[model samples]
Target: MTSTLTAPVQPETVHAIEVGVMQDRIIPEPVGPPSYRASYVTRDTAPGKARRGVVLALKTWGLEQLADTAELLVSELVTNTFVHTDSRTVGVVVTRTAETTVRIMVLDTDRAEMSVPTCPSGDEESGRGLFLVAALADRWDIERVSTGKRIWCELDTKKVQP
Candidate 1:
C-alpha cells in the first residue's frame, strides 16, 4: 500500500485564508436590538460599502436623521484602516448602547505599534481621519487585540433632528 502526505499549513497562512473567506461572506443583520456588524476586503471601495451598511442599519432602526453623521464617521474609520495599514480586510460593527447612544467600531489586522492618531496641519493632504472622528464622535477610543486593533466611536443619536 502507498500513502500520500500533504503539506502542513502555517498558522499565518491559515489566518490569511480565514480572513479571505470572511470577506466573501455576507454580514448578517443584528438579531436583537442595538447592534449590526459586517466585514469587508481592503479596497478602494470598502469604506463606501461599510458606510452604506451602517446607514441602512440605522434607518431600519428608525434613526434616519443620524445616517449622515454615522456614515461619515464610518467612512473615516474604514478609510483609515485601508489606507494606513497592510491589513487585507476590516470589520465594522454599529451598536446602540442606550436609547440615545450609538457606537461604531472598526477592526483591522494592524498592530498598535503604529503611530497614534494626530491632527494634521493645513498643508497636509492626509492624516486628518482621526481628527474628523474626534470632532464628530461623542467619544472614541482604540484598543489593541490579539488579531488586530479596534477603533470605536460613540454618537448621541437622539440629538439628531429629523
Candidate 2:
C-alpha cells in the first residue's frame, strides 16, 4: 500500500492592489490674465445640467462669444467624466481671461490619461465630443490632478478687444 500527503494551504495570502493618484497638468491655456470665475459641483448624473449652468454663468459674465463653445465643451468634458469615471462628485470651473477670452475646466476623480477626440469614419455614434471641443475652442488639453483629471478649453468671448 502507498500513502500520499498533501501540503496544507496557507492561511494568509498576500494581495496586491493598484492605486492611482491624480496628477494635474494644463491642457489648454488662456491667452490673457484671469478675470471671472465660476464653479459647479454635482453628482455623477448627466452633464447637460452642468453645461446649461456654465452657459448661463458665462452669459451673465458678458462672455457671449464663448457661450456656444463653452456649452459644447462643457458637455463633452462632463460627459466624459460621467461615462468613464466612477460615480464620484464632478465639478466644473469657468474662468474669464482678459476681456475676450474664457477658460472652461471639467474636474473628475479619474486618473486615466485623456486621449484626443476622434470620430472614426465620421459614422461612429460616439467619440465625437472632443472633436467639437477642438473645433470650437481656441486651444484645449487635459490637466492631471492629485485625485483625478481636469479637461479644459479656451474660447474667444467676443468681447470688445482692448
Candidate 3:
C-alpha cells in the first residue's frame, strides 16, 4: 500500500465529506446529504438490487424500522425504470435526512416524463408500482431532468412500524 500526505482539510472548502459508515454526522452541516448510492443494470433483478442497498444503508444508520417500507418503495421505482425506459442502468440513493426521516431516489437515463400514477382496479395486473409508492411513502414525486427522470419518496422512522 502507498500512502501520500496531503494538506489538512479546511472545514469550509471540502464539500463532499463522508462520515464513517457507522457514525452519523451532526445535523445542520454544510456538507453534502448523507446518502448511499448504487447503480445497477436495468433488468429483472434491478429492483431487488436497489431494495437490498436501501435495507443495508438503513440498517447501517440504526434506522432498521424504515428498512422494510423503504425497500418496497424503492423497488417499485427501480422496476419502473427497468420496465418503462430504455435506460441501461439505474441509480438508487438512500439518504438519511434526519434521525427519523429518509429519502429514496431512483434516476434513469430516459428523458420521457413518467405518466401520472393512477390507482388501478383490483383486477389489474400492472400499473401498480407508483400506486404502491404513493400509498406507502410519506411523500413522493417525479421530476424530469436533463438526463432522465428522477423519482423519489420519503419515509419517516416514527411513521413506520417494525
lDDT of each: 0.81, 0.64, 0.77
Q: State which candidate, 2 or 3, has the greater TM-score.
A: 3
Give a tens-digit lDDT track for model 1, residues 101-138.
98999999987495776667889999888888888988
Model 2, 1-162: lDDT tens per residue? 999999986533122122234221112223545433323333343476666667766666766555666777888888877777773556666777556667787877777666655566767788777777787788888878797887888876553342
Candidates by lDDT, descending order = 1, 3, 2
TM-score for each model: 0.81, 0.66, 0.77
Displacement of residue 10 (Cα, Å) in model 3 is 20
Ten-residue region with minimum lDDT total, candidate 3: 20-29
Off by over 4 Å in 3: 1-31
- The Cα error of candidate 2 at residue 5, in Å, is 87
Q: Clashing pairs in model 2?
A: 22-145, 23-144, 23-145, 24-144, 24-145, 25-143, 25-144, 27-141, 27-142
Model 3 lDDT tens row, 1-162: 999999986553222223333221112224576678776777787787677767878887888887778888987888888889998778787788886789898988997656777778999899888878888999989998888889899998887666
**Model 2 score (lDDT):** 0.64
Error of 1 at 65 (Å): 0.6
